[model samples]
Target: MTPAAVNDADIHNKLRKELAQSRVLLVDRHPEARNFLRMTLSAVGITSVRNAGTAHEALRQARNARFDVILADYLLDHGRDGQQLFEELRQQQLIPLASVFMIVTGERAYRRVVSVAELAPDDYLIKPFTADQLQSRLLRAMYKKKHFAEIYGHLEDDAFVDALAALESLLARSSEFALDGLRLKGEILNALGRYDEASEVYREVLAARVAPWARMGLALALRGRGELAEALVEAQALTEDFPEYLAAYDLTADLHERTGDLTAAQETLLAASGRSPDNATRQRQVGHLAVRNKDLAVAEKAFGKALDRLRGSSLRQLDDYTNLARVRIDKGDIAGARSVAADLRREFRGGKGSEAAESADVAELAALVVDSLAAGRTGDAEAAKNALNAALARHDSLANRRSTAVSQHLAVDLAHACLAQGEEARAQALLRRAAAEHHDDEGMIDRIRGVFARAGKEHLGEAMLTQVSDEIVDLNNKGVLAARSGDLDAAISMLSQAAERVANVQFLVNAAKAIFTKMNRDGWDEALAERAQGYVRRAQAKDAASPRVVSARELCQRVAKKYGVQLESAAKWKKGTDSEAE
Candidate 1:
């Protein structure tokens, strides 16, 4: 036999050995289909199997047990499909990472939807496939997940360097997994903020083949490098080439927004969500872009659909309800707003003392405040103001135990309420507190500015912001002068002191630069390295997309390399934006 044929035979035998002891779940509404899957799996010695005749039942069984493989049919009862179920399972994180999911569809058209989803199954099989075909596809998925399990574990733990090391070891040890390892390596490099390295890997992959994933990765790398126009061209080309790919649409939308084209961004997400209606996250994103574009009708429709998708799933969030309510208010549908607000309060009434419940209280009161003002009911508006004050007082009493992040959110909500009730002084105080706590968040600053601008308090808000900015700039100038005068210690001290007083991105970046420059001049200090890393990470957390922040982080990484020390990348940050209401 030829050497290639011998290797193929060996691989087939290994797959059979692995499948013999696997645990499986079969989800098909038809009894005949379930029987076929059962018989086929048992023929391969996969005896530990279960069956579910509906999507609801399948979800329950899948959550109850950690099956190694799941074969789900495309069509289920009650207008639901296997793809919807799969999306929900992933959205709610109900399935284990190692579990292999495969879709079984009778319709050839099903391929189009699966090809585009952000969370697709491990594999898929068409109807009329023989037991042999099933075994081959299932075995391939199982083996891939098994081989990369360690790398996946490292990624889950946010250890990007360790994950890259594991991927590198796998690539060197075997050529069979080279493509998979390279794909993972690209992802890890992007996560570590090493866009140049990621771009190189993607370029190498595309040199060998015209791969869509590689093309998308290259687009992201371009964006990370601040080449927005190039990234936009690449993203637009990718969307045209692969119209069904959901992620390409997302990339296109982001690029559109970055280029000040909110209308295009809104249209892109709206079209993508129309194709994949079961994706709640995409629906929420659509609502956000719509609101940003001032399309309240579209925002309401999108949020309503998102709320429907979140029904009977563990993926529901308080924002889903609040967003719908706020959009309703924006659309002048006060009754709808009240209904949604009531539903939100009822859902969390059981957990009154919990942080989430308190946040819900703030949201509900904020909605009521807006509703009252819209109806021209001054008395009701004043009542909401009192209630809001009571809630804020209670939250502040427990502020010592909760995070300042929670307080920042509460403060914003309260500030909005204050403005709606015409309490300018209270609103100004809350705005100042929010600014002091979250000064670096440009999105929040813009959102607060919008709120005041609507209330004819724009001058007041801008005055306060200008004062804060002036103080910060003065401090930064002093630190810069110190560094230029050969007093690195004084520069670092001043910058660090400013950062401690108010967590802003510019201050953090300044502190990081001084600390790293000092480390480069003097021999490395582990403590100093740690302190500098902390500054860069804080800056990244506050503003990862800013070119200035990205450049500062890259410089720190270069310094760490020169000193032969490791500098960990910051974990991804999730900030609250104005669209959180959507």
Candidate 2:
């Protein structure tokens, strides 16, 4: 006896009427599964359905078409899985907010991963479901997305006030969407820096039901409102109740750090790591915290774990290798540092060539210099120094004239290498340059000061760095005065010239803003647009993790749009579920 096919004529007619023009994509490794999905879709009057057997093929199909509905299996062929594919698509901005992404999985364990994800699918369905069940989920998802379009547009435009108003209207108009509207309203309020209002909205949600996300939002809102004790209690309770909630762990650790409980913060992260050991981002955060605490053992262990997780993935970065090597050198384990440096060299050697190739080569040579100095291999250190100089010189010639992609961390590495080679004057000059470029950044200044102390020249480095810092600060102050005087062009010129002299991210961001202001007043100029983007790109490369840099990046996108310049990755942040809205 064969299994009977699902035949629900009334359900098909209803779904078809509701989703008349919908385009669907089915991703499954099994041909039988694809055939079954296609038959189900066809029965529901959805004839435009594409099929892909692998994640890569599915990605290709998605890129080629704007799919209204994407039904992906939890497990795909080969190493790739549906979750990874979904993340890649979102990262690349290949998927739109209005589209529905469904996780169709037979495995019950898939729910665990979905529950804690920062971004999850719009809907999920367990396998072994009837066609009627599939139609019901799809219709609900489509209805929500369609109804939320007006609020989404305002939110995308950064019009939080307008978005809130629209959400209020939606709630008043349809009780069916009250929870979604309230959730979105809370997120918009949070983004607008209205923590008090956001907290109220979140409390309203909690009154309706105990949602993990709402609880997280309430904690974040409390923190934003400067109610640390309250936020701490909520986050603590959340972690105890839902240990799988990664955000709760992160929030708990951050609050502990803010309150000066470093030990507690470390323990919280360690506990979370025990639960989800494969999360590279959490491992990196743990390593950074441990390093700040001067706990080399914990830092080393966390970084090693991160390296293992990042291995063979595109997410692997030079910082992971450099950070681990730095820790080893601090621990006086020259052999360990040498091994890490060798691994770094191998990691970049086979990579596809990019403009940053020269920078990477120079960084590798600088790392070798550290390892050589630690081992007392004077000749090897000298060779590495020469190679590093050659690499820098090549980088100078190859770099774009309009771009100042200065990496302060790389400069610190070179300064350390120069000090190792007994070139105190050159080392001092390099460190002074970095300090001058990042004068307003107390954290970067402290890091530079620490490096100087490691070289036994703390007093001398401090005096030189202070002098340069004062000079740069004065120059920036003059630029600000010019901007305040309504001379946008003059402000841009002053700040941009200072940026060229110092390769400062602050100067570049200011100049970019001034240029944008000028363009908005005096009409768009292609030259200014290009120059602005160059500054944004340079700032991004120098300090990608900084919130200031991220804000600058967002402003650059707005400026690009104003000037009709096409930009990539212009989306503000990750967008998928309610969590991303916050």
Candidate 3:
């Protein structure tokens, strides 16, 4: 044999040895298929294997254990496929970046599967493939994972600076994976808000070849730098050329929204949702945009589909039911709205206890408000009045727990119902609470305005929203001014009080940032650090992906590292449900 052949043999043998030590998970609907694959793996000296018959089971196993390789068949039950499952796993961070995920499919479905997936798997295998082909692909993917391991480690720790350095080192070597390294570098730069560098990196890639991801990255970079017109042109061109690129559509929709063109945004989301009907996140976005555009029919369809797709998944939220009901009520479908309320009650009937019970109570109260709205529309005055009164009586008890969009929407709906009953004081109070809690959210503010307009109280909404905005600004400025003047103690106290008063993401993040700054400057105070951690948790619960929240977290992490303190795991700070990219 030639020298190159000999070297190839040596590398193959080493990879085989490593594969024998790897853990694998097999996912297929057919028992025989899994059995055959397991036996094939065992024949190759790979004995550590687990099997899951469905996507849900695979997710459960993935959550409990780390697997080096996951091989899933393309077709699964419940109207889902391997591609969708892979998307879910990545979105939820259930699988580490270093793991290999290969999708197995029939030859006929390969093209469709490859073209439509928003995120690609590591590799693909056609049915009736030999053990040798699987092994070769697995070895290649594992090698790439090893090559990027350092960068992945930095990313997992949220160390963007270190990750970029690692990427630069890898790129400087001009290795076979240099293109992939550039892709990752662009992502990290964009995440760090370094739009100019990101745009340059993506442009370099585009100059080399017509890569879809590179184009998408360029559009995102442009958008980040406020070059919306150029970004829209690039994104629209990508969608026109490669209609299967769903991320472009999302970016395009966001650009339209930024330009205050809700109609165009709704149209863009509608097109994307139609292409990927099983994507609950996109469906929810469609619903939200449709509602804003007053396209009730589209809103109803989008929310209904989201509820259906997320029915049995852990990702389902109470917002799904309430959003659909609200759309139905707006469409004048009183009976349809009532049916959704009934489903909500049935879904949350028997709680799991403790916090679960409290969640159930919140859902129940939300459903009551929906039903009362339906009753009012149907002229059942007595039923409407009673339900509305009961919801109002319980409102104060749950006020402090209103941290999510669901609760905010509930407050708005309750206020709308109160206005219908001519209770101006009660309606104004609910509106104030919702506005104060979500002061930084332009979408929620717009929603509150929509409710006011629908009730013929647009003038009242302007004055009330102004008051709430001013109050929040005053609260934030006082603490900021105190901190700027080097009064750390007073700053911490004032910010903490602001957080206590509103519990909004802005206030909570500010409070945590102030505490961490003080801790970083002075000696570490365990009590103060604990309070800061609490504020961070609260802010995360409200909006974990908020830039402000992320900044506060990074500050806390730096302080903890300086003090040699071992903080809690990042996973604990994540919300219970899966979150999608914006």
Candidate 4:
């Protein structure tokens, strides 16, 4: 039963450490396999591991325990297969988001196992394989799990900075990863906004073998660096080699969209979605594009399919719900949109459980904006602001996921509301602020471009949209310098002007925050106050507790009420409203 050449102690230590630090569950019908697993784990420096012999016992173990890893046999002697037992465990939510899942099966069972993509285990070990494979797999899992744990946790906690830092550390340390580690590290780096580093990683990886993911990653890096045509060419080449690799299609679509080729983008995304209809994310993207193009039927179908196939992660599910609600509004189903919005709100909140509380805050805030928008009740913007502010307050005062999202959302939402209320200049100015602050959000940039186009300022939006990455860092530095001087009005004016000059919401948000901070200390002027309220309203829509929005909520409410106007939620919007949102 011993794995040849693998230190039994190392396995045991790993199992115990993981269990103690997070969650892990073990299931085996054979007493010897159980003993080997426990002893091997114990020898590896792990001190804790739970075991069960029967399917029922395994399920019982899963229900009572919060485990980070699950090791199950393909064949459980209790009539039920190991796969069935683990599937049941997952459905019950015993495994936290960070759990490392692995399945042990004899090669003989490979064909018998159903092709349940949704139930795909994170790691798999064939029976009779050497202990080295198991140990290697476990080590990689633990290290990667630890690295990614914070991202999942931060996304859950709405602590964007913590999440980003975790990714950065992962990238810095990935130099030591032998092939396997390097690939995951590159992905983490890409997710963390270090596209240049990720591109280098991918280049090195491709030097040996052209992995689909690496190729995709490189395409992304190139695209972000403004090498879109080349990126598309590379992606197209990769797609030919790996016809079924759906992500390549997405990358290609991104290239087309960036180059102002919506027709090509739509066709490419549609092709990818058609081939992988079961992937909710793909379907959602297609729906998003179709809706943006005013192809209401296609958008409705795509979004509806996305919602039905929403068996992925929590974040993916919420995004689908938000988009689905938007599609419903396009269909003029106000009641349906509201109902979906309500459902989306609940899903976004997730649960009140300790493990879910932080993410729940994010979802609740997101839902408020989405719901308010769908209902056409500008009145709900106040609640959206309140929710965002409250959610942000749950974390630290500065630089987190809730703060970033809330800040960006607030700027964008407020701009839309202002535009809706016949305040084009104010809305355009707020949008400019958002662009400066949230450069990574391509979708937001696209939406704001429509706004500029509607306002006959298409050239400005195009200029900003095309040079997002370069502007983000520069915009921040210049905005701060403008505020540091005695020229508070000039600072606000310059920042607002730069924001309106382009389509980057993050940049706009960054400038808006700077001016808002300076103005609070100086004195609020009527014009600055109008623009400031738009930014505050946007932040409130994302997280009512954004540092600036929370401080400015009361003033914004008073201003909005005085104007007899309400800011619509981001998630809800009628066709007429959406048309003007550009």
What is the C-alpha lDDT profile of model 4 across 404-454, one tens digit per residue? 233454445445434543456666666766665555656667778765765
List where candidate 2 sits over 4 angstroms from the true fold. 1-94, 104-120, 154-165, 222-230, 258-261, 350-373, 376-407, 432-446, 460-485, 497-509, 533-569, 572-582
Q: After superposing candidate 3, which stretches have Cα over 4 Å from the reference?
A: 1-18, 29-32, 52-57, 75-81, 112-119, 399-406, 541-547, 575-582
Q: List candidate 1 segments past 4 Å from native.
A: 1-40, 47-67, 70-99, 110-121, 146-150, 153-157, 169-173, 311-313, 351-381, 397-411, 432-443, 466-582
Tens digits of lDDT, candidate 3, 1-582: 999899879977887899999999999999999999998888778999999998878877777788899999988865567876786777566778888899999988788656544246888888898888888889998888888999887666555566789889888886778878888898878776788999999999889977888888899889888899999999998888877677788889989988888899889988877767777788898999889888899899999998998675665678889899999988899889999999988887776867667767888888889978888888898899988998886676676665423467788899988988787899998889889998867678999998889889999999999999999999999999999898999999999999988889989989998998998899799999999999988787676545566667767877887889877634434424344421
Candidate number that wins on lDDT, 1 or 3:
3
Which of candidates 2 and 4 reaches a greater TM-score?
2
Q: Each model's TM-score, in the order given? A: 0.72, 0.75, 0.89, 0.48
| Lowest summed lDDT window (length 10), candidate 4 | 573-582
Q: Which tens-of-lDDT digit does each residue in 443-555 have in candidate 2?
A: 45766877777779889877887789788888889888998899887899898898778777788778877777777778888888778767866665555434345555556
Clashes of each: 0, 0, 0, 57
Error of 1 at 334 (Å): 2.4
List pairs with backbone clashes in candidate 3.
none
lDDT of each: 0.72, 0.71, 0.82, 0.59
Q: Where does model 4 exceed 4 Å of error? A: 1-22, 25-122, 126-177, 184-201, 275-280, 307-442, 445-582
